[model samples]
Target: MLRILRASGLSSSFTPFRALLSSSSSPDPQRGLSVVFFGTDDFSLPVLNALVEARDCDGSVASIEVVVPKLKDPSAKCTIESVARSAGLRVHVPNRRTTLKYWGLPGAPPPGGSDGDGDDDGEPMEIGPRYDVGVVASFGYLIRPHIASAFRLGIINVHPSDLPRHRGPAPLHHTILAGDTTTAVCLIDVDPTAFDVGALLARSPLDLTTLPDTPFPPPLPVLSSTLAGTGGKLVRSALRSWNATLDAAVDQDRLGAEPSHAPKVSKDDAIVPWATAPAAHVLRLHRAFAGSFDAQAFVTLPARRKPDGARKRVKLLELDVVAAGDPAAGDAAQLAPGTIAFDKPRKRLLVGTADAVGVAVGSLQVEGKAPCSAVDFANAYLRRLLGSGFVV
Candidate 1:
């Protein structure tokens, strides 16, 4: 079962049932291409659905099939299998027998069938009668060179970031952290070894016009879903002519671009050392990780009534950045950075930062508690402080 919980108060309204039109007007799939798609995450759903829709409408694909979702957790819900099966596409799970009972479909590929067949002997086997190409989007596993070579046209990937930049698992997070105003999606030739080092087949730029210079930008999920939609279109376009697209592929190595890496984000990297970091930087971290599981920013605070100085971690979900005021103004200088204060009239909780910036908590959650508005947080934990001059 998939456990659904709000980490950063962001949720995806995207569903795979809906299909967006491709950029190319009236894409003709009569190019005699059969696609074997590999993907796992929700980011891959749109691309999968788009191809299925194209195959249903035009002859864009002679046949469309999918690999069993590369599940991160064996027991977790598989988005790729769920979506592919729902679209009535053939799903192949490596080393596992396929049956109608497996996917709850009446007429799916049977076990030991050619579709789920593998080239374990290092010998390249024909993918299938109509299967000539492969499409991968956000697939968790790397395709082996032998498996990649089996497809007549090889594989193409829909990457969310611009080629040679922000290449890795956390591209969306890194893009927001760097305050990039523009990011793009690219369809590239899969190299099967390096990350996003593939030759480019097509590219589409996404304007992040909503990212604020100081405040939190859009959540990572929203940006990822948007890019996924754009990537789906680009994938569809590439299907129109794989041979021509591959022939026109541009080598990223020749571009002489110094690429920034976005390795997977870790728990330690998500914790905000509020006392040492600038408020602007902290805000960026909050925004960048807003939608990431286990990565929202948190600050350690002393318990209100515990004289023993027992500390509690309060997770920040949403916040606003306020320009730093002169510390010399009033008693502002007397408060230490990370000190909590309340604004009664505005009903906001403000945390002091080293750089004199004030971060007004828009939403927060106590550890092991549901997220609530800042006003609610103050009411629950700082009610007495609210009466005593708004100090916490």
Candidate 2:
């Protein structure tokens, strides 16, 4: 039987279903596990889909519910709420983003009740396991200790990078920016105090060499999609062999690998350091952030007819490293870093780098103008400023 708890002002609804096992009992392989799935972005969709499929087809998942962040905009498209509803699954959301920090599992007793100390009313708390397990993927908020302890088994997270490496909010973005040749999707136990420092439950390596058509260091979206698919399979397998995978889990701190951090990508990262960074570095920056909603690489160019050295920001929409044999590449070697010149023969804008190599700009967008091709930018913005050689 399932019981629904509906919120008054928010679109949140919770369906509490009894687990096959008792509160103190371990998961029964024959009966499968009840799951509370927490996720938010596109990367989380594949794993959620896998669990939903498992619930219907196999015995790996008994029941599943989704918990997403409250929708701030009702008309927003491509949200997890819409996706879960379309799949006919019950969804739960917090009243506000900050509410998650004090959130408790649905059907679980309120904090400061019989489960611990009595509440202000001195009423007894209902105590028992609310769900068999919790699974989180790309759910930006932290799950507090009280919320994690409500489940029979603690929360498991699907992290994009290998354990003990790239541990933070923007692992995928950091992976691409670092030009790493290999990465992996990992399933780990969620540490209540920190993020991405969980015990490793499973992992599937993404071999860059095997990606077809594109050269090494493919675009961020391509790599992200591939990793998401792998993560789905890995989590499914872990749940299918629940006991064995749990018993074999290893602590990330004990793993001997050096730890690294992947802080959130910011506007500062979008500023192209043409004067100090190499051409390859700039290319990596473009690949990492070009597809992002806000963070795209940009250069500060001198404003037209401004004696105060006023500058305008031009976003580099598309960029490529100039081959050593290209004529523009040779001409760029003679110019200083941050210097830009229009290559008439190639019909592209070439900019020098710190390494004396040039990078070709395929398309760009001025501060207030629509994106335009390199040829158009050169014709309109470069022709008049050629005497001074429009240096960024």
Candidate 3:
């Protein structure tokens, strides 16, 4: 059965199996559930903050603790540890990855005690506390079976995509690249064996209609923040009615067809494929990687006067499709794909694509140089190569 709750232009829905409730044990209503949350980055913040808020206002959450990976840099900004500490929540850092396999729960004795003593390999002999449940969001590490079993109700994950589809690390990026019109946040049981192949506790669809004037398919950071906030709300609702939602959870195989994967984005995805890609595709790439720190779309320009025909990589900092009937678009239509030409009247740098319409580059960064406007780039680099047969 599915129940819908709407707020702030977003809809939260639950898919629960009535039959499972009879067999499952429910949390005590008086004290609520003791939750240990696992998360790491910016995407994890909303959910973490939501849990903290819920713990304070209602009895649904009795106490909350956070678990984060040991940061390579302790002073890094915007991390889960900092946020958790600010909220006055107890934070746990495993000595190493393997330590979690036998680590104790919050309220358990410190390591080296009878309840927390581990083997020489850092594998604890006796894990303790056994919290009511564990919540994971954007926590990349897999929870081992022993650690998962330590929680009475097991662990639940707040994933950004609907399970059984886009089931990997980079769902938001892939969703924009595919131009998906609809997307949702899923609350699922954490399958110990794999990622995102879990039972659904709740699913919430983001209302794209709310963003009528925003860029089509919305930029990556926009979509991510929207979904993360929605996921946090859904989680709060689920925890408040923990028993009912958990019992209603259904397997991914029952929810949809064959799974489609959203693989991790790499630097290669940033390399513009001008030879065969249309201008619309370039626009999609720009949107997909807009806020990405490492993988912004770029074009390779052949050296202007190099004897060995070397090429320089220029990162496309900002891009847009040329409007229809624009004179620059008409002029760019005459050039071959990958050809680069400056639009003097508009002060724009246009690049030819597989389609007749071209992509206009608003800002770009030449190799080893600071980012500059299209006019500056044209003056500094395109002057000699404009009519000299140098194509991007």
The lDDT for every candidate, in the order shown, is 0.62, 0.71, 0.71
Ranking by TM-score: 2, 3, 1
Residue range 9-92, candidate 3, lDDT tens digits: 211221122322444567887787899998888889899988988888887888898888766666553489888898788998
Positional deviation of 182 in candidate 3, in angstroms? 0.9
Candidate 1 local Cα displacement, residue 210, angstroms: 5.5
Model 2: which ten-residue window has the lowest total lDDT? Answer: 1-10
Compute the lDDT for candidate 2. 0.71
Q: Residue 306's C-alpha lDDT in candidate 1?
A: 69
Which residue window of length 10 is worst by lDDT in model 3?
Answer: 1-10
Cα-lDDT of candidate 1: 0.62
Clashing pairs in 3: 16-248, 17-248
lDDT of 2 by residue, 1-392 (tens): 00112222221121121211112445785698999988888888898988987888888999999888766675663367789999899887754554443345566654444332222433223244577888888887656445555567656788889767898888888887888888899988775445576678888888775798876677778887888888888888878877777667777888899999888877678777767888888888877775774224443344558654445567787788888988676887766777778887877888888899878888888778998988998777774442344334
Relative to the true structure, candidate 1 reaches a TM of 0.74
Q: Each prediction's TM-score against the native?
A: 0.74, 0.84, 0.83
The collision pairs in model 1 are 29-59, 29-60
